[model samples]
Target: MVGHVVRKRLYILVFAALIGLTALTTGVAFIDLGKWNTLAALAIAVSKASLVVLFFMHLRWSSGLMRMVLLAAFVWFAILVALTLSDEFTRQWTPVPSSWQAQVQQQAR
Candidate 1:
């Protein structure tokens, strides 16, 4: 009974922290961060998600196996994002074939 109350209090604290983080994120969005915008947004999002998982989901008190599962999920998501970004950023530097450009020019003529 008392444990449940403590858990609820902890959840309230986590919610407050999440709200603070959200405000910070919104504040940062108004500033000219240049290339840091994406990084800052991702950092705040991860922090908020961590708090939710730790308190709301009760992962903090869970067993090792559960923790590992959570870690694996994060790892997989990171890998997928990294691979996708790598493809996108790398393609920006590649040049289109002159043959294709010529075909488009001919079609427009």
Candidate 2:
């Protein structure tokens, strides 16, 4: 039923876009983006997901309320990812030396 609803041209274009994005992701993997590698990959991934949701999932023709719900869901997901990444990025993994070792050795004497 869904396939019967969407036009052939639209499907063809979406397929082409998906293929192009796949090639792009592969190409980007070979590039040195330094700290921006994750950001660039994420951006491309989001674009591909959006296209799939809009066309393949038929959300583009869905009701306004459905679109609003999807938008809200995406916003919530972004907030969660931001919060998690902030915590991750700000964490210090270095081990700090404590004076307890010296104190323990002194006590042993």
**Which predicted model would earn the best lDDT?**
2
Clash count list over all predictions: 0, 0
Write down the TM-score of every candidate: 0.76, 0.76
Clashing pairs in 2: none
The TM-score measured for candidate 2 stands at 0.76
lDDT of 1 by residue, 50-108 (tens): 88888787787778999999899989999999999999988857676677878989999
Q: For model 2, how does the per-residue alpha-carbon lDDT over 67-91 read when each residue is reduced to its tens digit? A: 9999999899989989999999999
Instruction: Give candidate 2's whole-model lDDT.
Output: 0.91
Score each candidate by Cα lDDT. Answer: 0.86, 0.91
